[model samples]
Target: MEQLHNKNTHGVVRFITCGSVDDGKSTLIGRLLYDTKAVLTDQIQALTKTKHARVTASDAAIDLALLTDGLEAEREQGITIDVAYRYFSTVKRKFIVADAPGHEQYTRNMVTGASQADVAILLVDATRLDTSKSNISLLAQTKRHAAIVKMLGLKHIAVAVNKIDLLNFDEEVFKKIKEEILNLANTLKLPTPQVFPVSALLGDNIVNPSKNFNWYQGPTLLAWLEGLDISSEKSGVNLRFPVQYVARQDGSAAEDFRGYLGRVESGEIHQGQQVTILPAGSVATVAEIYISNGLNSFGQNTSVEMAKAGDVIALTFSEDVDVSRGDMIIAQDNSSDLLTKQLIADICWLDHDALSTSRKYILRHTTNTVFTKVKNIIQILDIETLSQAVEADSLGVNMIGRVELALQKPIAADLFDESLATGSFVLIDEATNHTVAAGMIREAL
Candidate 1:
């Protein structure tokens, strides 16, 4: 067994915030940061003493919601516009939070944030049960987001039914919302999601237990996040690494060393296992593993014959091999039938211009980038209703579509539902080198 580290180490957790603009995603994040004392003292002072926080005494309550609703339009509309990212740390964990927009128009931004997320916090407005984008029917928005998120491959979620004070602290209302949310989640085949009845305005069910809803009993949002599994193994994936850099002999004890440096993208990587290099197709055993090398990469030389998933280590192969950045390292047994030139993909269209068969973009999968043209818009995914439209001619901005892509060269990737780390890719505008869309591998098409 590997040596256990100290308890005080900060385990990292990245997550996205969901729900409509009114579900208090921004306010909930602010409340979580505030109650945990994660926000700086200067910011906290501004919260209490600043006259700018309020236009009048009626607004003098120091709207914690104002603290994170960063966009001017967001402040005016009282909703999140763009994806607002915030970072903070508690005693047990360090967090990178993406408070994504709740509007249907901003679904692309939400997808960008969802790409790296391990947990999703779905905020539900308790007062208005429906899920509309901007009004009292917020549950409509909640259900829509739930479906999109599950389609986007997020399973672990925390449904924070916030703004409960306006519901008279009634346990029945809370129970009703929780049950509805769970039912929707179950419909999407999402895992058993944790639901927390919270009041971001009053800091209830955020940091500590709430006195407002005395009959309700559950862990607070913070406690749930704290207990969330940050283990790299949770994704249920096999070991794979995309080689980032290759290190060779230097001075001192490193003179005879050769290492393939990269962070493990999924599963476990162990020394002495036969590993294969992609593109060039070379195979060798990991002679040694390294960390703390002269270079500022993740791993160096070591005797770790077996390292679990998510470890970043430098692996020394037995012989000089043609491995470089943009090449993937795979366990010999894990290698399967890799696609060469044709693939069927589900693309989340992020480009302002509509996509058609004639458009050519760079398809980047794992460490390789290849030129490609979309063969067809097979179907557009209706995330809100969970249906597919078979006859769509074009995919507009923020639309999720299943399209046939023909690549200029072969790339290594798996089916999206099979392995998210290696299965997802992005299409870049060859001219501008800007990412135009995100795609998931469905199969060769």
Candidate 2:
């Protein structure tokens, strides 16, 4: 139940970029990092040195995509192959950009990267917009990309129509592509995503305004990113702080000292507040909220008495509670519902072996892991069409399905839409020790 309720805080926004195979996603990421001065001198030199064999038919003095597409094969083929992470921050906010590869087979990487991101940028090549003859396969792939991003819970999406210079900066093409994507977004029931026409290669509308697109009026990508905030603004929600560990001064040093360690997952947790530990249903009042760097009883220096929403703090309890890892603390006031039972969720399959209907795996939710079996694959959404179909017996790689997981014992988790911390789980194949699927909590926890 740990929640990120504050929308105004200077938070780290993780984003994933998805697009057609030739939409310049890697190039766009490189340009964003370069324009922001996030690239260092040594890394820049490394990029220049690799230019000997990294040339494509469309080559530049510096192959910017080399800044992100790190694989040797990818460099030789002039394509992105793996999901690359590029971290940077600006004057206003911090960012973690997951540059996902665009090929159809790499869809699992996109899902993995998408799992941790707050927003998504879908880049499109304006010249190759929805062509029935040339881009038939690409159009189908783009539809799946949008559907998967929505399923992964990206609150805000930005469509950057890249390579406008190739189209002579055509305004009509921009409008037509924008309208087409808008229609598709509406069909997916996703939040109305904003669109920006840009040339990531030419540095137009990326860091600053573009001189070539005089008719384009949308906010520049940088300005838009700076202005945007996390959409999960559910403040005043029920408190959910799951305990990760217990630290104590045992036997001798300071026998009276005891603390429960965990991050603040949800609503505000103040010192000396009443709380109930889940599963055990033990009630206690917080005696002191101890942080990693706690100060003594001096009212001179600055020390936060209370953590707002996202801050992590350790707490000492009034009562001698036997709380351990995987336990949850609920604020006493809002104890309406607590669950420990069967659950359903949307799953992103990752294993090359199909998810057999009768198979069992170790399900990890937060710090708790339990043996679970695939009860059913209730709704299998056609990735290309973005619509649900009849029940399938097995799920393949990169295929997303709404599954009902039957646990050997009841587990404590929240509906993903209700609380992301409690609502997410991963499935590990017991025999091979490989993570086969990533799932989010669904209705009726």
Candidate 3:
């Protein structure tokens, strides 16, 4: 029921770079930060230290990787082991860039990055385009990461053909790579990805135009990113505000000061608006809305006429209604007919142990956790082929599959394509209490 709009007053665009190992993801992010002059003097000075290895041979030059590869272990190995997030701003917009690990073992980390991204930069190494050998080569991680980002619902994808310097900035090589990427996108039914020939290490066609590639006339990566309409991608289609706590101001004068505290995941709520409480459809009118100073530190209760999606506030009802933590308050205008206990979901298995139907796990949706069991593994998707292996019994580490989940209690939810906030859930291991899987509801059973 939330109205979709464009351009948040703050121009922030969140994106991620992912591909095979040694594909220069960290370097690309580092170069973006460096070219934008976002790095500080002390950080630049630290890069000159003997321990920080520079990518180029120049003594005065700094290795851009040092700006992102923060961990000691990652620096020693010269690889990104986890998701490295860096914030910077250009003249046109602010940016949050996530440099995801390229190794196949860290696919879960890539998924974490993809979950929050509005756009994705799929990096491809120029050297990996070699096709003269008898055996054809494919970057498995690149394909896998592409599938993961697409599956996670990112519509804007940019294919950066990196390391063009190594190929002498060959126009034909760029064409070949671009064509191959287009073919792959077509096979996956993904939106057409804009291709750019870039050298993250050499700083070509990233923040500035590359003089080397005369044939390339499109906007630079930064320019393209600045031009994107990311406002519509910030929130989902439905209103979902899950109550985290209930604040009661008990006093002789403030007798009517009882409020439900929560962050609006999506959609907006207004004062005197009619709202429905979910899992128990009780209707109530919002008497007052108060924006708190902090999550726990509620110093000043600033009364507001309305609260938009993403605002953390408290709602006082006109009529005293029984509401508690884990309950949801949604707009009464939600049109989805879905209200069920069984769901068909697409899941990314993150646990070391495979997923089994017989085992019970805790399914956490919004703030509510309930017992759940995997009733059946319908199919496992092959990332490269874009084909499903029908009738899979279980899912292994990093494998993506569609399964039937039986919940102990019924929930008011929506299709993932309808609303991401209400249609997603996480599977937690009973024994280790670790998040073993992340899932998106495809449909109700």
Candidate 4:
């Protein structure tokens, strides 16, 4: 059995499988895991012993979809209900795969998965699409998922034409689906999607090339994913550190030992660097930086001198500044201005209850939480046509729209296009504490 934590030469590629219902997102993930030799012997035995009820006793093939659909409700309904995450590694690269639900009602779950992914593998079931017509239309849920992927700014996209074995490996069908997917990508202004013909159930064109599709000559799905270059794009981003905790010396040993503890969301931080504390407009010099290194004999975190992006560190300032848990520490030379109390944003409504402008909601951005309300709904998006309509007043479940927000206090936030860490936020219902919506800051008003 191949261990999930095996070292790879390249950085981990985080991706999500998403599309319309019955697109074989879970099965595709299972196939990738199985073919990569990531499944343990005991796990494979368990899967073989408890095959799907639909499979006959004579059938020797294991139900691969059972590996990911762990929820009993999901197994009974034969559909994915929540986001399922799995890890596997090859000699060249490591992978973190997310199996996102395809149902329209569970769109929020998909959004949660896509938020952290660098690539998206959208599965299109060939049997579900009508290739006989001149103008083959994709499913409504497929279009919706693509639009959401574009909105979230995913750069790499791939369309896997799944279940091609059912269509007798027809070249014309694959070409038609590929053309329609290209058109959809153009309409949504997404990056040109790389299309491939695959049969997730039969283990064709997944980890290895399939001999059934003689006309097609493209790299296997795993090959393309392993060779993707996403590191350059992640580099050179500006620093956006949201203070999560304020650490101070308990006794008088150090006397004035005060440090701001948080993860460096982007860019890098060094000792003696000048930083600006947001919302308060206080300028301070970094006296010392301490990167967290596990725990010592006393169970206290050991420290180092410098830290970079993705590192959690404690930074002490030269001056005694009024820094709190919600305050943000940014580079003094940062180009964008990120302090504002009013904002215009694009939001996805996730709650069952409709958004009410009169009701007060809690807005949590980075580490800051403030009371907020919907001042006005700018427009509602029509997923099918990709048009914005201004006639709508309230947003319903799984609906994406633009809205203006009025915050009770000013916050440090960059536009979503500028910095994902500082721009994204969630709206929580004050009464029930349920997350009602996810918002991306478009502009500060």
- Point out where model 4 deviates above 4 Å: 1-9, 51-60, 232-237, 253-256, 295-302
lDDT of 3 by residue, 190-230 (tens): 88999999998889999999899889999999999998877
Which parts of model 2 have CA positions greater than 4 angstroms off?
A: 1-6, 9-11, 52-59, 71-74, 127-138, 234-236, 252-256, 293-305
| C-alpha-based local distance difference test score of model 1 | 0.74
Better of 1 and 2 by lDDT: 2
When summed lDDT is taken over every stretch of 10 residues in candidate 3, the lowest stretch is 1-10
* Global lDDT scores for all candidate models: 0.74, 0.77, 0.83, 0.85
lDDT of 1 by residue, 236-298 (tens): 446678887777777786477767777677667766789877766778888877654445654
lDDT: which candidate is best?
A: 4
Give candidate 4's TM-score: 0.93
Error of 3 at 52 (Å): 4.3
Per-residue lDDT of 15-35 in model 4, one digit per residue for the tens? 999999999899899999999
Ranking by TM-score: 3, 4, 2, 1
lDDT tens per residue, model 2, 320-386: 8799887888888866566556788888888899998777899988767889988888988786677
Give candidate 1 regions above 4 Å deviation.
Answer: 1-11, 49-60, 66-82, 87-94, 128-144, 230-237, 246-259, 270-272, 292-308
Clashing pairs in 4: none
Candidate 1 structure, TM-score to reference: 0.82
